[model samples]
Target: MRIPVLAAVLATAASLCSAVPANAAAVWEPCDPAPLQCTSVAVPLDHARPHGAQVSLRVSRLPAGRPADRRGTLVLIPSGPGNTGVARPVTLNLPPEVRDVYDVVSFDPRGLGGSTLASCELSLADLGGLNPWPAPDGGISANVATARRVAAACAGNGGDLVRSISSRTEVDDLDRIRAALGERRISYWGISYGAYVGAAYATRYPGRTDRVVLDSLGDPDPDRLARGWLANTAVGAEDRFADFARWAVAQGMAPDAAAARELFLSAAARLDRSPREWVTGNTLREALRGLNTDAGLPRLGQLVRVASGGPLPAPPQPPPAAALQNLAAVATATICNDVAWPRPVEDYRRGVADNRARYPLTAGMPANITPCAFWPYPPHQPIRITDRGPSNVLLVQNLRDQATPYAGALRMREALGRRAVLVSVDAGGHGSYRSSGNACGDAAVTRYLLTGTRPATDVLCR
Candidate 1:
């Protein structure tokens, strides 16, 4: 039975003395006075200390057009550990069948958008000045100092709430949202980092999970977690770069794929030795990331052509300080909180050495050190993903995703075992479902979401 609003308030008052009512029926109001509705969800700051403090998550809903066909709500989890979800439905590519039967819901994770906010209070210089990519020479001497200082800044300004932003913490928050909605079970559609969150939620609360879909799956290695994700990018980028090289040759930008690859590598090295316009080592890496997709390849080709020979182009404008600060704070907090990275400087040094030798295209950036190595607070142990939960998961992956490659997703697929059915799309890029151009992959996901059907065996979308 739904608790009365007054009873909900009294229950919350008894527990946390917070004004937020416990599991109160959401008082939905028009977000734009259109069809979209919005509300705030109150959850504990620390699930371990439920009565201590609280935070509010901004939640939005696009109610199903055909109520008669509506089966349940489908929550869309955004990609970045720092990406806000509350505004995602506006741009999400939802199939008509799925949209007709589900109220699409999303929320801004803690420390983001309308939620209880925290910032690292970092300077714009520090935000843009620091590069996640290590030196092209593979010397991480400067990176060590920067990682330490950045970690310290986050800890100093982020407060306790930042320390608690993690996949496990987010699972608790998800459950709280489910409870607040008065739903017995909730469907989930999570992409990239959100896939890890969805997996953790299913592992922790399998009974409450329904029609779960994990797109662009991340490595589920508990000990390594984000460390593995960062390192795997070297291989992922090399695989995706081949596609771009082929595209460049076909577009007449280069004589052939091999020549194109060599030219790109030379350009990266030249930029590293003497910065030209916006073509610094960091920007080169960022440009390659964009080059992984069809939609982005044309722009990448233009950049490459100019870089080969031309006047130095102007540096692109950096993001506003506030946006950068928020992103740095949230991304740093989430990864650092999930698990500790190896603290020894020599470990990263050795790893970078190996990566540079093995994957020159990536230039060892994937194995480089990050602020997580210097995070002050001890992190919770990561959840070991296994085939112990309900068999209700659908994994959609691209063959060559730059951020979450096929190799890493294979581990996730193996770990899920009988618990999931995977649709391996023969495509290149980070995401698969609606983003991948393959009709087979899109149809598979849409069919699964609409009818709860799974192939008897894993299928490759060709």
Candidate 2:
């Protein structure tokens, strides 16, 4: 979801669990911090040769209250082929019901957080500034060029760590951690790209799972996996963007949302013919290209606020190296290893032209060519998404999520067969349950996790 860079790789980094002790592969080390505890476990850096090399993984836990209430451990696997979701347990603001039943456990996967770290020696300019978005006026030449540059920088500088950091490896590493923890099975909550990890883990080791939730899913279609998500982003962006447009018009600008939407489209169209230069250095056309979804519109509103003489949205900050590394990892491993992108520049040009005509809101970003176009290597194995898993899996999703839209989530629902139930929330955001508003949503999920029971059928949360 949203390229899995955030949950996938950002999870690669984390803070010490102050209250826990750092015993080598020991269970429940008590740290000094009152709220949390931490420890380190060792796992093979490469699963293929598990006994060959070891990497230290940091684990944090907030012990369940009352020994009697504690049922098992809840492991949170983050998104992205690279997202570092180590700190999720501390950050989840878990419901008291869940807290009493499970020792919330989490760890940064290898190559992220306290495990080994990898930094691409990319230039500051390449790392920072507004992200390269396709032109709103239907020009993707800049984005195309930028993708090549970024991919080249990563391939040239990314070391062995990049090569080994993959979805399959992370899942194997997770199983090893579960064994080291001495837990017979683990309850898992995987969001966005994490859903794919959870699916993979569940499929590969069906018996090892207790309760699993795949929040936002990436298609298990090995052939399209990441590429499909990237291509379909335009639909998500357009859907969510319309929501914001309605909200903006009803609450502020231009009276009714219907009119505001037209205005928004007109503004973008105007930029196509004559772009207005912004303080951000990119023209409005360029900004529109980058601002594909609701995730990006808040910042763009600031620009509109200024142009309209209202309060300008604060200028956006560029991503630092720490974040870019994760983004690069998701783009590289998934895009490079997934279905090959077309080679001739003309192929991209034609696709972009076709997509832009069909879906203008996202321009061609969802279908745009990436550096994977020039990938130097082929996949080590064909991708596979398995439906075989525990029937307790629950998928909670927003109707409109730019990063991972409803359509993708539906595909996941079908793939899981009766093994999972879908809870569609009437919300608009990237994540669901705890992140999105609605107690009904939070309560339903919490009940399932705490009791191992779920709704009889797919239910809508509104």
Candidate 3:
């Protein structure tokens, strides 16, 4: 899975079963799931150069809560084709059905948590400024320079570890992880970008998979891969914005169906010249950039309200330093490693111009060039997303997700063909299994995970 970088961007439980003895000091460990143990698994730094070197991946397992007779290993592949979430074993509180029947497993991919790390050493400012959201007039100058700087930084600091972070390598490592755990067939629960990692694994190691649940999918088209993922933000943004708009109107923007868009833009334009003083040099547009983030879901109309004829919403405080950097690094590496981006600054300029003209709501953030454009290395292998896997896949999507839009999810649905079933949540948010808004959608996914039973046809939970 790729770390969601602005661009950096579940649960359940049951178990009175005496708390399993926990790993001490645990800082995080290399562990194997089942036999209900934790241990380290090592993979070559560069697989092709086997004896060259190696890195440890943290792995862990939480056993099933049901019939003592084990079913299969169910790995909760964490997001970020690059965040070391190997600690998931200790973090998640899953349903008893999940714990008792299958060994719930997950690992920090090679070179990730508990494993070695590759850092760009980006300063906090650079991290905050990576996802160039153009100026109100849609400027791209600063964004372009930042992109190159980031690319160069990665090239300089990434080291040998960067070379091994590919989707294929990850699948291979997963296989090795499964082997080390002594499981022949494993099941998967992948959310967001985890869906990509899971799909790649199933495609490469079909016989090794039993049941799979992919949530918030991106288009599997390789060439257009992350670009597709990036662009979907516009769709996602628009979808949520519309929701916000409707809510705004409902809140008396006008005649039930408010058309107070002019007011919002007027406020933005007003702030463009005289930005509100939430912080130094950061204006309303810049503040809105925070809203453009993953958690800045569309329902923010509650915050986007106009005051004194100005749409000056109170901005939230920025996140912590370490939290921001690690997340940012993971997203940048995953995106950069996965594919090469458009290089011609002119291409990005034109793309941004076009996108701004077409989808002013996203302000050209999606179409604008990223560090991927100047990535130091090309993708290890061409992206290949075939519908050749088994038919045991289940996809659950929300009609409107701020990060992975419904349209992209549809493309994934098409890519999988008969190999998958889709469940659409009738809500507007990114968290699919349970957004706290769609119980039906949540129940459907939970059912599939617990019983391996899926709907005959794609169903919309309204």
Candidate 4:
């Protein structure tokens, strides 16, 4: 999936919160609308060298409405390696109960939002190269060239700060934030990629976490890391497409679900042979992977109809060039710096061929090689998630998430073992709690968050 970069900048503060010691008093100022406070914490550029060069990370908080009822702090970790959480405190539609009990907090990781920005200064073409979509004929020559070019650009342009972006550094930064807040222990609500971060934090500092929630978790296997997550998308896309096909059939796009699948495959193959306007086989495949949610069904159906000789839809407005570049730089640095990807182009060639034959909807894009394969530096020590933490963690996942998927969530659950309980929702989408509209799942999560209670065993919500 192509992750979008959120570059929202809060209004300038009358006075900035200068960096202070982790235990020093936190100086929060009114940076956004009323009731939202912002601050910056100075963290070492490299966690290992605590006395060396440092960078500041912007943090935001929405104080609890009833301070007397305050339980503790709740940190909302952002999703993408490129996504920022500083604005989430005011932007997310958090439940009133949650807002009343705990102070909601979020932050821009080292290389995002109002923290310290990092860029590769890559051209728009190179930024697009970050996604390894194979050619129409399932060839990898173009992909290989783009991957090498993007990797070289990042290594040359992105400085030490960019190279320092990884889950391990992020966990260190989070502990500093916790210390800055003066909270002996903190609760967490992390989604998507943030789930991995949260898992790593819980594993590293199990004693510091009170109540933890991991939503839409990916595989926590250290050996594969992001590589395994990417490859698993092939299965995720095929599973989610079944839901889309049923929706298309109900919308009268085809006589039945099987016909809808046939129509989509045929249209994609036709576009591969001859492009229609800006629509190509790879573009359509990416669109399907993105539009797997119920809310996205209508737009996806329209795209399919257009591909089947209907009128073309208006093109989407592009994001700012700088935003795109920052996203590509940070995502590439994080994924590549987190683990070692296979370097042989032949590995991707064979994998893509097999993936395309097995899952035509994705067209082998998920298995295709990325800039990570050609990254300049080797990965640092990896964080291994195990069942060594407290039993304070809770996991919520959708049955069919096109990005993280159910299979990966199962792996996470298995890894966590007795330390966590799984709340699986029988649904087709990306997120579950407070997103999929599954009341059962929502109640279980909310109850756990409020009362610190969890299911004795894994529970399925339908």
Candidate 5:
């Protein structure tokens, strides 16, 4: 059973100081690919037993361009619980002025990238079920079977490291990084799921945080955790699909937005009934969710055109087997270990059926059962985000984000209370700051980071 929000908050507050060990300063060395310095920080595999087995987290840094103006470290938290941040310092398109004042840092969370690795060694078929996309007809029986099998695989082969992965673990590791960097407090910029990490860090180590930005937030409710984030993709998909439809009509893919919607739905339905060798209904749905941005419009339009009986595109290359296994293991363990999923298969069946009728674009996939259902480990105490933190957080969210929709972001804002000010950008995409190209939203966040002044109240950027 899940803990209530207030109790979770109290539990988190009680353990804040004792959660991790004293941070040892990181020994940095020049790594390959100039300008990116790298190091590793060893954190306990389990925080409860700090002296037990250890896991090394790979850390990287791109020093401030103008050291004379350097304010302090600004950590860039990775997006996926599965995504790595070790290269973000070099890869992220950060604004020059911000880069001039802060030494940017990032890391591969445990079970990812260069950190200690763990794998369920899931087969290709089991790996495909990680996202829990429902069958074409909105049935979840196959999803349930895959969930059980994947869960068993992880329990049998993932060992202690995989079982240890969770958002709380990531937060603990981040605090250790702060100590290793020898900074009294650190600024942060976290996108998508990373935003949750930033919020948790701020809550747990409020005094140790400065100028913080949470872009593309997921719901911060402790009771639901990642389960809520997953189910919410149904709503997110619909909100973003409208934008895609409008773009499709503008690009002559259909007569109007309504026709474009029909075109996509019809194509997806036909594919559901008779899937191509590489493309299926779920493939189209996933593509629609991924391609909801302006930069992705052209490809999304082309995909819809082809799916409407035009020539088929070549299949994309598969990811490396090792990488796939690592991602599946980490993502699965993180979500499942964060909170207990409902056990009854009927719970998912009802959810999938309801979502399929209301949100056809997703075909109930977002609500389908996952390996979390059969996960062997019980969850750590969920983090409860509250207004106890400093008023140092600035949240920037797009109006229509497919992955972490605006509606859910409101929950994050509500959870943080007066501790955060929100910048709502009238855009249609997953990320809002630089990724959305919204000068208004970018200006708000940049201003906060550089000057520590958020809007006097919540503001909308049109």
Candidate 6:
């Protein structure tokens, strides 16, 4: 999710290998031909009933370059509730300072990749056709039926993997991984949904955490959870779009910021009515949501320009059904398990209409019905991030994050109380650490993780 500068600490660090028990052997073998060492740790399906049943989690580790100076294992919690973490070592480009002092570790959660299989078996066509954005007129009758069908598919096919998946279970799995590695305490670098998991772990086992970095945090509302995250997408998009508009204006896409917004809105509305080309209203909204920085502004502007009233492109090919089925299976399980969503058809209709009116940029996706509405089971109580933990947390957030906005992060910041020191970067994008390219923000995170030097109060990195 987010990175560097402690040669002195590396040279003076004590070997933590002695803390591990001789009998607690974690046999880590290279994952294929990659540099990552892979292993599996067994944990109970349900933490409440530890003696009932068990499941094995696939864990991967990027060993510290200087094993003699390795202080502890640094766990990288992947972004999605559905995203695979075992492949994280390949994607994660850590600074030498961080890689030298800590063995980077990550794992796939219960229902994702190598660990376990849970397929919803949804039709490829249905998955592609199912847009969270309802009809332009805000009619949700078809959307409601689609939501019901998807949920039914998941209920029938997801099986025990869906039933056992929850934030609580995952956190417990993380602790088990720590024990398996023979580390008394572990450090964390969690982004987006991963940040929520990290907060849950820190609150539950504050004493067992050495240093925690909650990057691009989500709202930790006890009742809302992912729902809150979904709902905030509209606000985040609007905030981020302003930055994009400025970039577009500079790139000569529009005369002004207002013109850029107007062009995008009008073009999106036109596509909603008569969609002749490959680009549709949903496509535009998704592009807006996904454009995390200025680098994406020109392409987004071009897409909007061509889709407004220009020539059509070739018809796009539909993705394979198996892939969507896997993603839906895990994502639905996670969202449905984290919290309960509104169940009635009217609730969705009203939400879509209201959201569409209030935030035209996001259309109605944020408030529209998901598989959670028809989930067979109720959610386990969502965990609340509290000040009951150690003050070992460092939060690095961008002011205008599309996925996790500054406002939502403020709630997490407030919830953590004195346990965290926030490094607020004056930027407009998502994931504020190394990826932001803001030296001030990156340096703060690297310094905290490497040297354990955090500001006594929150610092604004501009």
Strongest candidate by TM-score? 4
Tens-place lDDT per residue, model 2, 1-462, is: 123322233333233232122223465556534477777776654567755545567777887876697899898887665666656777776787788878888777665665555544556665552143566555768767766776676566664555565677667777877876678889989988788788878878888999888786656677777678777676776757667676677558768767766666655555555544543223433454444334556566555444434454445564556766655554465546545556777777777788877876655656677767755555545336556766878889888777788898888888888788999988777778787776878878888897788889999999
CA error at residue 269 for candidate 3, angstroms: 3.2
State the lDDT at 47 in candidate 1.
86
lDDT of candidate 6 over 307-365, digit per residue (tens): 65665545446545555555677777888888888888788888888898899898888
Q: Candidate 3's C-alpha lDDT? A: 0.67
Which stretches of model 4 miss by more than 4 angstroms?
A: 1-17, 33-35
Error of 1 at 376 (Å): 0.9
Instruction: Write model 4 residue lDDT over 1-462, tens digit each, in one string.
Output: 322212211111112247655677688899875678998887777889987667778889999988999999999998887888988877876788988999999998877767767777777777766678888889999999988888887787677777788988899999999998999999989998999999999999999999999999899999988898889888888878888888887878888878988998988888888778888776677787785468988777767776668778787776687677777777888899999999999999999999999988888998898888889898978899999978999999999899998999999999999999999999988878788889999999899989999988999999
lDDT of 3 by residue, 1-462 (tens): 433211110000022122121121222233433244566665555668655455656677776656566787788888765556665655655556667777777877654555444556676667878767776667888887888888777666555565457766777777777776777788888877889888888787778888988887887887877778888787776675655556557667544433555555555555555545552222433333334333453324433343334454556666566555545665777777777777788998888898977865566778988888888787767447567878999898877676788898898888778889999877776657744357787777778877778988999999
Candidate 1 structure quality by residue, lDDT tens digits, 216-274: 98899998888888888887888898788888888887798889888888777877887
The alpha-carbon lDDT assigned to residue 131 of candidate 5 equals 75
Which runs of model 2 end up more than 4 angstroms from their true locations? 1-24, 27-34, 129-132, 269-300, 307-310, 318-320
Evaluated at residue 147, the lDDT of candidate 5 is 90
Error of 5 at 266 (Å): 0.4
Prediction 6 TM-score vs. true:
0.91
Question: Residue 365 deviation, candidate 3, in Å?
Answer: 0.7
TM-score against native, each model:
0.93, 0.84, 0.83, 0.95, 0.94, 0.91
For the record, the alpha-carbon RMSD of candidate 3 to the native fold, in angstroms, is 7.5
Instruction: Give me candidate 4's TM-score against the actual structure.
Output: 0.95
Q: Write the per-residue lDDT of candidate 5 for residues 70-165, one digit (tens) a residue.
A: 999999999987888888988888999999999999998887777766678788888866777887767788888999999998887777777788
In candidate 6 the C-alpha lDDT for residue 319 amounts to: 41
What's the lDDT for residue 117 in model 5?
Answer: 68
Residue 236 in model 6: lDDT: 94
Model 4 poorest 10 in a row by lDDT = 5-14
Q: What lDDT does candidate 5 reach at residue 345?
A: 91
Q: Is candidate 3 or candidate 6 better by TM-score?
A: 6
User: Whose TM-score is higher: candidate 4's or candidate 6's?
Assistant: 4
Error of 3 at 44 (Å): 1.9
User: Which residue pairs clash in candidate 6?
Assistant: none
